[model samples]
Target chain A: MPPDTTTVAPQSVAPSGAPASGRPADDLRTLESGLDALQAVPSTEKGSVRRILEGVLPPVLLLAGLVAVWQLYVVIARPRPDLVPGPLDVLGALGTAWADGRLQLAVLTSLERGGVGFLIAVAIGTPLGLLLAEWRPLRLALGPLLSGLQVLPSVAWVPAAIIWFGLSDATVYFVVLMGAVPSIANGLVSGIDQVPPQLRRVGTVLGAGRIQLATLVVLPAALPGYFSGLKQGWAFSWRSLMAAEIIAMGGTIGFGLGSMLQQSRELADLGSVLATILLILGVGILVELAVFAPIERRLLRRRGLTPGGIR
Target chain B: MSAAPAVLPAIRITALGKRFGADGPLVLDDVTLSIQPGEFVCLLGASGCGKSTLLNIIAGLDAPSTGTVTVASGSAAVMFQDAALFPWLTAGRNVELALKLRGVPRDKRRGKALELLDVVNLADAASKRPHELSGGMRQRVALARSLAQDRKVLLMDEPFAALDAITRDLLHEELERVWRETGRTIVFVTHNVREAARLGQRVLLMSSRPGRIANEWRLADDGPRRIESPEVSRLSIEITEQLRREIRRNAA
Candidate 1:
């Protein structure tokens, strides 16, 4: 990323002009205050106008380009109407699904499964991460196993989960957990690892006990890492939920895009299958925009980790 | 900012010695010092002179290899170069955190934190996060947070080295004043001789490798002694001569 070259020259935040400046530390206090004033505000205002335009214009052009290419491809392929539904046709399917109420149900079911499983994964992963990162003996014994599990594909868990839980929501949840727990734990571990030692020493000098260390020092220090893990864990949950839905094949499962595709495949309706896949993609992007991106932006904003070093 | 008044000697380190490995170099060799209750003392030396190690010992953050360190009152808090402020905390909350750990009441903490920030002259930006602060601002907040310990001693390790010249100069004055007003003992370490001279009531100079106190000076009764002044230059030359001999001996 190009460093945001924006400048925001804030007059010192001390509206009182300066602290009682005659004393030694008081002058230091005034200077410190001035610097703090600079800190509390960010520099984004400088290039925000240009940035807003830059951000908006290019994505619009990219979408237009994508649509144009799709149109051209359709014109060239010219498949039979039932075989090749255009983007409009898939959108129409989306509309019908919504009108039929099944879309809401399908989405709700998938989300419920992903959400519950992801939460459980985080709960398990956080402590597991703490152990993996802090407890040398435990980490030594389990670290490799945890790492190996993350790389082990979610699909590999489906067969085992089917055998263990046998086709209910439990099966889907089990698969999701299996897929995500490792990543969550590992994310936390890495977060803990990245925290500078100096911060930890601060905790010690502050007389932090074990719980205090974890809550105040370790956890906060690992936040950016934890958030990143959560993002990845959610991805895993959604992906694993889809996999389990497709393969488990035994539930009175709702018409989630995953199941919808399975049904469409069984009936050999390629257009519906394409529509279902597109629906899933759209939902993922929408959730990312509405949920995760906002969170990431929020975390970044609080830290004034803005593009410009405002002060 | 050097107005922090001294009530008592905040810290006294006598014949303090440290040696890391059995067969290796001595880190701090027979160092003796006393920090007046509100004095700003900077330990000026290159990387391995045990400047930080000595501060660590005084802060009671690390045990000394030998000798005794006695503090007049509460534990000394350390301010690291990176601000070392908890990122999870808002700037106000970070200060409050120190109070909380020190057993300051919950209700009292917020008010006290504001007061401390006001003392540091950063009362307005309480809610800002560390990431929101610039490099210099973060260190200032770090200073505030350390001060929140209510301890009479504050040990800083090259805390302003990372900041720019303008910010560094401003902080030096800030530190000076904080020490004076709060009457807290401050033991700051920096490689910068001027900074040591600028802030310290007395600067303790050290030679490298097997670090030893090469020289010391009392800046009291001096009228804004410039680093280039005859007195400052004489001391620097003497210390540098000692440093040169040590380096050459090590090379040999």
Candidate 2:
């Protein structure tokens, strides 16, 4: 990668004309200047520790304030410990669960089920959505059903799923599939619908076959929508798995967060119940931050579509 | 290569007509023209003229309502007014997609894309996405992508219309150089009289409202034509006057 400065010459690549003829070799000059004007300088904005601190501080302070308020309410109300656990009691219960490794086991079990179920939903939903998008008659027939399924809460599927499969992993998976597939499929459909007509024409004129157009052009163009669908699908899958665990009890299925929540309720361990609720909320928040947010930010940044980048 | 057979017309439009729906008005009616190999022909008309429609049909993006259109050699590639470079792809990747579709080997595509970008004087910008580039740069990438198709005919639909005057002038020179180098048959559609005069060896003027070929001019002169040249300005003025008359006739 050495510069090889000794061999370099300062000559223009554009064709030169005789000075007497007077075309003046301005074409190359014009091109060079025009490019100099058009080529954007790469962004130099740096993410310093100060900026990171600024971003994190508000959320941290808000959570602390909420906890303080909750503790104050408990102190004033002085409810019986068994009836309503204070924040400290819930934390103590969480610490004990963590020490015994029950908390870890429940978290792992629930996350594994949610991950597998959401992946399956994506596998089925993406192509279904693409098919629905491309074919007019199919979209007309089935589009409304997909939207309706999204509106129906994931909990509603638990009874039907239990009846179909009889308190097994199959029942849990069925519930997850019913809950998630519609959202992913519908997101993809809307994504496909939003594809600019000009881009499609560009694909056609570039000699892409129908399949090529769909896979290469339309699919990549729809990434934003697909990612949004994936996020929603994950949310639904988690909700559906919890619903299945809560309703279809005494299963041979492993201990999950939902079952733990139900057990704590039945035993009337209010502190454990609060701890379980926190764990569920924590897992959802963790996935949103670690998995979805970074990918979405990168996608938008690469396209220069971030609102901050516009001006 | 020197012994290669005589070159044929690159594009032929015969008795072509186009309409939208069954009840829609005719957009183009009985238009016929032949463009020679390596020729630069400009299609010029007013706003409602079906010049863009004709280019679309020539590019095979839309079908003619009647009659036949033939391309003499390889397929025609088109450059639209907007750059239409996929926002998801980098500049080099945008050009490489066309090459990929044309069945270029995967390993060769990257180098070939860089080379094409160099032809448009954008080798340094290969990694930039469409949005990172300004209007002119994006259009340059679009042009490179069209060239990667390696077609005999290049159909441009007002490709420079969206650019500012300075950028448009620069592009005119760049395009002229490319046409000279590649010897591709170019049918450039534009409403700009000076642009048509500067670039085209022949200009075909069409009348609007059931667009039809109303006049033709052949600039078989001896030298390179610049847009600001007296000769080019004179020709543009002549064409503009005739174009105005056609519009008035339609209005009347």
- What docking tier does model 1 reach? acceptable
TM-score of each model, paired residue for residue: 0.84, 0.90
Q: Lowest summed lDDT over 10 consecutive residues: which window, candidate 2 chain B? A: B221-230
lDDT tens digits, residue span B60-126, model 2 = 8789999889998757999999998999999999999999999999999999999999988889889
Give the per-residue lDDT of model 2 (tens digit) for A159-228.
8887888878888999999999999999898888888889999998888999899889999898888888
Assess the local accuracy of residue B207 in candidate 1 as a C-alpha lDDT between 0 and 100.
Answer: 78
Q: What value does the lDDT take at residue B164 in candidate 2?
A: 70
TM-score between model 2 and native: 0.90
Per-residue alpha-carbon lDDT of candidate 1 for residues A1-311, written as tens digits (9 for 90 to 100): 22211111111111333433343444445555556566455454546567557766887799889877876777889877677667676677778778987678878877777788889999998888988888899999999988888898988988887778777777787889999999899989898898888888999888788889878888877887888898899898889888888887756545565777687789886766777787777777777767887677667666555423221
lDDT score, candidate 1: 0.75
